[model samples]
Structures are given as C-alpha cells and as structure tokens.
Target: MAVKIKLMRLGKIREPFYRIVVADARTRRNGKAIETIGKYNPMQEPSLVEVDSERAQYWLGVGAQPTEPVQRLLELTGDWQRFKGLPAPEDALKQAEPKPDKKALFEAALAAASSEPVVEATTPKKKGGKKADKAEKSDKAEKPEAAEKAEGGEA
Candidate 1:
C-alpha cells in the first residue's frame, strides 16, 4: 500500500495549525494517521515547526512521499537534508534558525502584481501647480480628440 508523509489540518478557520503524519495514501486528510511525526503552527510569528527527526527519516526511507507543503516544511526544518545522509540534529538546528526574508518575499509579490506596463499621465505636465490646477489639467486632457476634431469642423 502507498504511504504518505503529509499534513493534517487542525485548529480553527483563519488560525490554522497542522500535524505532520505518516498515513496510508487512501486515508482522509485529517483521518487516522499511522504515526504523528510533528506539529506546525503557521499562526505564530516565525511559525512554529517541530518534528520527530528519527520517525520522519524512517518513514521517508520506507517510501512515504511528502506532499509539496510538507516537503517544504521538512526542508525548512532540515529533515530532508538530514535524512539524505547529511549532518545530525544539532547541526540541523543551527542551520534552521536563520531568519526568513519576509520583506523580500512581500516585495516580490508586489512586483508580480504590478508586472503589467503602466501608462504615464496624458495631462499637460504641471510645474509648481496646486492640486486644483493638476485636476483641471487632467479634466481638460481627458476630452476626446474626436470632440476637438468635431469642434474644428463646426468652425
């Protein structure tokens, strides 16, 4: 039978926590798991993640596949690197404590959302003009060129 290393969602809506578990692939997400491997609380600042390294490694070695998010959590906790025959828990702990680049991530998301090209204001450029003048210039510029052409034809 196929086994999975995945997260089981818990806690209230908007405030989510999870259990890292080893379970049969057919089991429902929050159903009975074969083993509880750890806990994850994304609600907390810095987000708490605790895992049983030995059990996690054992499960992986025996062919349990982790879901994408679970795999990321494992990487953050250094479980995958350790399981892949790297350093021990102490070294992993040392490496795991680095601060996440939240500001850089936020800026990257903002940049992605604003990726479309933006047009410059078509209004006459104002030099040392008050807000009201700027508004008037914008209103004047917004008049369609077709309106100007019609006015000229009437003349």
Candidate 2:
C-alpha cells in the first residue's frame, strides 16, 4: 500500500491543531491513520511541533512521501536536513553574505513615513454614529430601576 506523511486537521473552528501521521495514501484526510508520527500546534507563540526523526527517516527511506506543508515543518526541525544530508556550500555562502546598510534602510523608512498622509485613528464617522445610536437604544430599552431592584433584592 502506498503510504504518505501528512497532517490531519483537528480542534475547533478558528483554533486548529494537526497530527502528523503515516497513513495509506488512499485513506480519507482524517480517516484511519496507520501511525501518528508527530503533532503540530500553530496557536502557540513560535508554534509547537514535535516529530520523530528516526521514524520519519525510516518511512522516507521506505518510500513514504511527505506532503508539502509537512515537508516544510520537517525541514524547519532539521530532520529533513539530516535525512537529505547538509545543504550545499553555495547555500551556506549565500546566507553568509553581509546585510544591507541599516542607516539607508532607516532613512528610506523615515522618508516614506513623512510622505504618507496622516489620518485620524478614530473609527469612521458613519459606523461610529450608528454604534453610538445602537448603544443608546439598548441602554434605553433596559430598565435601570428593574436592575436596581434585582440587585437590591439579591443583597
């Protein structure tokens, strides 16, 4: 059976978690996984990723393919590097090059900021007026005397 390393989406809406698994390529996205190799939580600061490098390398050697995103995660964790061998000298040389002039960059940013038009930070007048109207209507709808009586009775 053809196997793949991929992510299975979990958690609630707006908050997502993923499990890295080795599964039959034909299985549904979140269906029966053959083995859970790791997990990733993107909600945390810096994100959290845990992978089993030895198992991952073994699977890759055995011809299990990793999906693109999972491949990136593996690369970030350096597991892929170890499996594929170190990067070429050309890549290392490119990274070793000196950074551009910071003073020039700062001056350019200052010029851009000065050229940009300043705008008030307040909400747009139309939306602000409508929101205020809604708040006033809601406040009028609620009986303060009734609220006071409820609080007084509770006390």
Query: Residue-wise lDDT of candidate 2 within 37-96, one digit each (tens)?
Result: 999988866577888878999998899999999988888777777778966222221122
In angstroms, the error of model 1 at 71 is 0.7
Task: Write down the lDDT of every candidate, Cα atoms only.
Answer: 0.86, 0.85
Model 1 compared with the native: what TM-score?
0.55
**Candidate 2 weakest lDDT stretch, 10 residues:** 88-97
Q: Over the full model, what C-alpha lDDT does candidate 1 score relative to the true structure? A: 0.86
Residue 19, candidate 2: C-alpha displacement in angstroms: 0.4
**In candidate 1, residue 29 scores what lDDT?**
96
For candidate 1, give the lDDT of residue 137.
82
